[model samples]
Target: MKKTLIAVAVMAASGIAFAASNVTLYGVIEEGVVLEKAKHGDTTVDLRSGFDQGSRWGIKGTEDLGNGYSVGFILEQGFNVDSGDEATSGKAFSREAFMYVNGGFGKLGFGRTGALSFAQSNAILTGWAFGTGYGLSSWTSAIGNNFSRMDNVVSYATPVFDGFSVHAMYSNGLTGDSEKWSDNNHYYGIGVKYQANAIRSSLIFEAADNKGTATADTLVSDVLTENQWNALKQTPAWSTVKDDVVKAGTAKKKALYVINYGFEYNLGSWTPMFAYQFAHQNQGRRTHMFGLSAKADVAGGNVMIGARYLFGKDKATKVGASELSVDGDVRAWNIGAAYVYPLSKRTALKAFAGYADSGKEWKNVEAVGYNGYQVYLGMRHSF
Candidate 1:
């Protein structure tokens, strides 16, 4: 009877070992040389990492729990190949660290993960063509200050029905905690995607509520240093409206929102894509962006080219009980192209070049516009 019990325990341990054997490890390494020409006419060249794609290593595993139920976990970390440092300081798995359950009821995930809207934008919008690093879509989307990932996330994704699916997520706080529970940043995102044959489309919405307890003085200091403020005070234009500027800063902070839509169609040899975004922030600042791109197979490789336009509307800030109009409208545009040549199934050589105009500086003291150019050549390998 003792030998029988021991045999049963050995079998149970074997089962556990078999389940653990399902775990998989994966990683990508990319390094490149980059040349950047700043808007101020300064040029710099350096050996950069993650030009085509961010370098990362991850481990993942799944276990079936019978009755069609399964559980999985993933831990991914991003690092710089050039400097051999973590992408995010002090964080081990900065890219992704999440556990999930999957079954007939779709999937539910918890912990740190990518926002639904950001995932949609990255996969279906900007990242489809030349990737997000130097893509024009990335430049235009920055107007919304969108975060790619959030911590303490609770997320759900529905099973695909007729090539359509829905996803949603909420984060208690984007990053660090605040002294007061209500003062932390809360994030919400939702998205819908459809993919059928050669056509793909997605719509996503995201928002963040920044509940910080900041005063007018703090806001002013956040925007300008003492030296800059002293210099600005010497200007006649600034001196006349100094009091109003200070009063305008007294307005309470507001939530930010973004709506993004993307569509793509594949036509055998060539695929075309389009994207649009609307962003609002600070109760006054608003922006709109549009993007168009195309990709084609050439010379045993693929080439992607794209352009984007961004427009910022005039802003208004609250001053005490009244509204104060600020002349902060700006317009910008970007154009870029990328090429990828595959050496093998998991290795590629990539090149990219882009130009961007940042439009006029949005300050009462400055009315200057700037533009710049960038080029990168990189190699990427996956394992």
Candidate 2:
């Protein structure tokens, strides 16, 4: 049973790092068998558990604290090896829990990590492989979202020069409500990368905020008035009482912004990737995405392909008093592929597939019943 669940998670991370004398324990365990299909609907099949990656377990500790300093910690989590669930629910090291301090002007951490522009835009659109395009490759759901993993952060990294490096982050939100903390809300990000030798590049920028306001059924769903337009046709329970008077209104701020750019190049065995992303909001929504990936080596192992495109705008709303509007130009396209072989050096065996579509006012409104497809086959190991 997956090596008895990795020997009971390495004996519960060596009994919680037996008093921590530089602990260490790692993990990975993938499971697969998927099928999916959706768009016109009906197909289904399952058994996927972190398909190509992301079934995890982790632990690491450090201590030294001498002139060169040191002190670290990390506890990671992610699961569902078929049905253990908890890919993050009630947080038990949901992904990572941090604490660090290092020297030479680099490394500094706090809690809940990730979000230096989602790890430099997923390592420049996955040139930093794992499960193809960001694990379990399915063309990364057409590259969107991401920029999560943050919860009162405060990170920093730097100490690579010549090959370039930099990262920064911030978060506040701190909801202990000092009268709603302010700065609108809070979150921040910054990134830079270089890597050299085979070329690599990255850039990131992020932001988040959002205050409060607008209620009254969200301003009568965004513009109605005159007693919410005479209580919207007076039926449907007064349109559910103007959406419960716009969810009991009062909140406004809405801020979000992002910018990312990536690049990669190699050769020899081939490698190429590119990325571009933009997402904006202040309350006008906007999105954009573009990606391309490639990897090669063939037969013995390795092969990946990817593509993506997206465009967006959304606000729409409006279902009884009319007024709010926007959604009319969003698009999508995706493609995916994967292969892997190995079977040693920690196991492997893989396959992947993906598809996506949209265009024509985002047919089916995206990922939900949007033209879809997926395929899987898996096995992966690591310890």
| 202-275: candidate 2 lDDT, tens digit per residue | 78787765433243123222454333443354557744554334334555535667787777788879788777
Give the Cα error of residue 70 in candidate 1, in Å: 1.1
* Number of the top lDDT candidate: 1
For model 1, how does the per-residue alpha-carbon lDDT over 146-235 read when each residue is reduced to its tens digit?
A: 557677788888889999988788888665343245745578888888999998888888887755523322234345543454466568
C-alpha RMSD of each candidate structure in angstroms: 10.1, 21.3
Residue 279, candidate 1: Cα error in Å is 0.2
TM-scores of all candidate predictions against the true structure: 0.79, 0.30
In candidate 2, where is summed lDDT lowest over 10 consecutive residues? Answer: 212-221
Candidate 1 segments whose C-alpha is farther than 4 A from its true place: 1-21, 119-128, 135-144, 177-180, 213-252, 314-327, 362-370
Q: Using TM-score as the measure, which candidate wins? A: 1
Model 1 pairs in collision: none
> Compared to the true structure, candidate 1 yields what TM-score?
0.79
